[model samples]
Target chain A: MKKNFKLYISLFLTTLKISAFTFGGGFVIVSLMRKEFVQKRKWLTEQEMLNYTALAQSSPGAVAINTSILVGHHIGGFLGSIVTVLAAALPPLVIISIISLFYNLIRENLIVSYILMGMQAGVAAVLCDVIMGLSASVWRESKTFALAVMILTFLSLALLSINIIFVIVACAVAGVIYFGKIGKKGLKNDLS
Target chain B: MIYLELFWAFFQIGLFSIGGGYAALPLIQQQIVNNYGWLTVSEFADLIIIAESTPGPIALNAATFVGTRVAGFAGAVIATIGFIAPSAVIIALLLFLYNRYKNLKYVNDALRGLRPAVVGFIAAAALTILKLTFFSESAATVGLVNIASLIIFTLALIALRKFKIKPIMVLIGSGILGLVIYGGLSLI
Candidate 1:
């Protein structure tokens, strides 16, 4: 732990730079971080990365922050988590604050507005990719019933304008039931 | 009064919206457009447009824009802070717990289950965003044949997938088209 202090600092800095440069949120940043941490530094295995990502997601923090903390703690103990999460979070937090302040005037300007509109279209495209990407993943991993739940959730909230809380509650119940069934079957199979 | 309510509403949005920026959109849209009437759906649409193109996360950008629209500078700060507060507080708490447990099996299992669920949630949110973008209610308000935007979108996707053109380029190029086309159309 102590020997790799320089390596950890470098990793922290690299993650920070990537976070600052990437304009999008967690998913894009996650990809960038994975490239740096996994492919470049050989710090974490792909399986480790996936495990950390899952932990980061379920935990209460921003996925980006959570991931940084996980990597930080894994490498350098408590202090490492602090340093990395700040490094990851600080860039976006500062940039967003500035953007938030001037955004109105920017929104009103014609050239800026048009550019924004174009970006809006681009956002939609990016989201389309996200949908396509996740669509395949969901189909592959999720049980068919679970996929049905997901599709229904999407249609209800996204398309028909149903209340989101209702959607969340419905999904939570479905998840609990699905897991309950799986847990019971696993236990039964073991008994046999 | 209304703006204050809007402020608190967005604060709640920021608080509850977990997973990522996209997750917050449906709730934010509901509160602002349908419930509070702080913005029209088209204005909200425009906000989404502006939010994506600019720097930072979309949810925070929405908070800033909607906050400003509802009130002023102060409103913007309040809303921005409000949106971030929940996650910030939650993160702080998680950091505290993480130090103690470090590694736990059930914690790991729950997280594994959660990953797929989050994928579901994000996919659902993405679908909602697409509807907000393309399948709009009133077609007249959108520019001349949104298919142009759609084409640009499709081309940009292909560029990203096949050619490996960076998203920033797509963003800038499409923005230029928006400027030229909308600017040109406004004149005519």
Candidate 2:
């Protein structure tokens, strides 16, 4: 019982530290987590960490949060998952809160607005790169259906102004039917 | 009433934002910017800047920032919980399923389908921000271009895509560039 308690605390602290320090995004946090759990602590093997990373990427929500949950579950079960998630989420809550309190001051400052305007340009650029990178990977899949879905989705959202939720649901249904028709064999070859 | 709305808005964002953190941007733009009108387009862009620079996932940071702006500390707490609740519950269920069956073919197929759409969502988001940054104000106003912003956009994009510079460094460098160009222009 004592040992279990210690493990939970350590899990919480490790995740909290990672969440607080990492600045890039989900993938950055995932790499740091791989270092901590798979290499440093030896809590998880490389294969297990890889599987969790893949699972987290494919699942949903925040990849960083999802990875933390899976690693927490592995170390401490359900309770462990809860602890790690709280740890993963708490830092942002605190940091953003402090920033928010001074929101007007920052917004109103000429220098700050200028700086943010420049940052906005950079952000737009970064987002463009993200789109290019992601689309290239999807294109590499070489699935006609996938390419069609990507193009149609962009048209619907950008031109037609369709609700994003509807597009997501429609694509999900289309995927299930298409993949289901292909059955187990196609699934293995296509995805794996 | 506002609290309820905030919770509901973020809850929906959390539930539907499949893929990852970037996937949440379109949803946040829809619900928070378009639907609720809590933030203007410029403010939305600023929020993204803040979220990217801060630690933690972009979705969580955006939620906290928006919530605090909308209500107060309590609002921040509610919004953050709403944003994370779906992931916590879904991940817990997924963990159980993984341990029990060890295979999630259906889920995998669903994700496979969702991947292209996610790319689309991200592209749309980039377009929105790009239009605002390059053309100024709305997309319809194409005549009034912010040449400085366009210059920064081109340089930053090249730095990120070709040179493979870190995003944080690019952001910082652009801020300095903006200050020098825009600030100097203001003086003249």
Q: How far out, in Å, is residue A123 in model 1?
A: 2.1
Docking level of model 2: medium
Q: Supply the global lDDT for candidate 2.
A: 0.87
Candidate 1 off by > 4 Å: A1-19, A27-52, A68-94, B1-11, B46-55, B68-77, B88-145, B183-188
lDDT of 2 at A75: 85
| Per-residue lDDT over A133-181 for candidate 2, one digit per residue giving the tens place of the 0 to 100 score | 8888987874788789989998999899889889989989888887777
Worst 10 residues of 1 chain B by lDDT: B136-145
Error of 1 at A6 (Å): 14
TM-score of chain A of each: 0.74, 0.89
* DockQ for candidate 1: 0.36
Query: Looking at candidate 2, what is the lDDT of residue B169?
Result: 90
Residue lDDT tens for model 2, B1-188:
99999999999998899988788898999999999999898888888888888889999998899999999988888998898788778877777788798888888878888988899898888889988888874222346887888889899999999999988899998888878777777786
- Could you tell me every candidate's TM-score relative to the true structure? 0.71, 0.94
RMSD of each candidate? 5.2, 3.0
lDDT tens readout by residue for model 1, A1-192: 566778667867987787677766677778887898899888889987886776666554346766777777776777777678667655545655566567566778977866666566776676666556656775676668546765676677656777766666556566666766777899999999
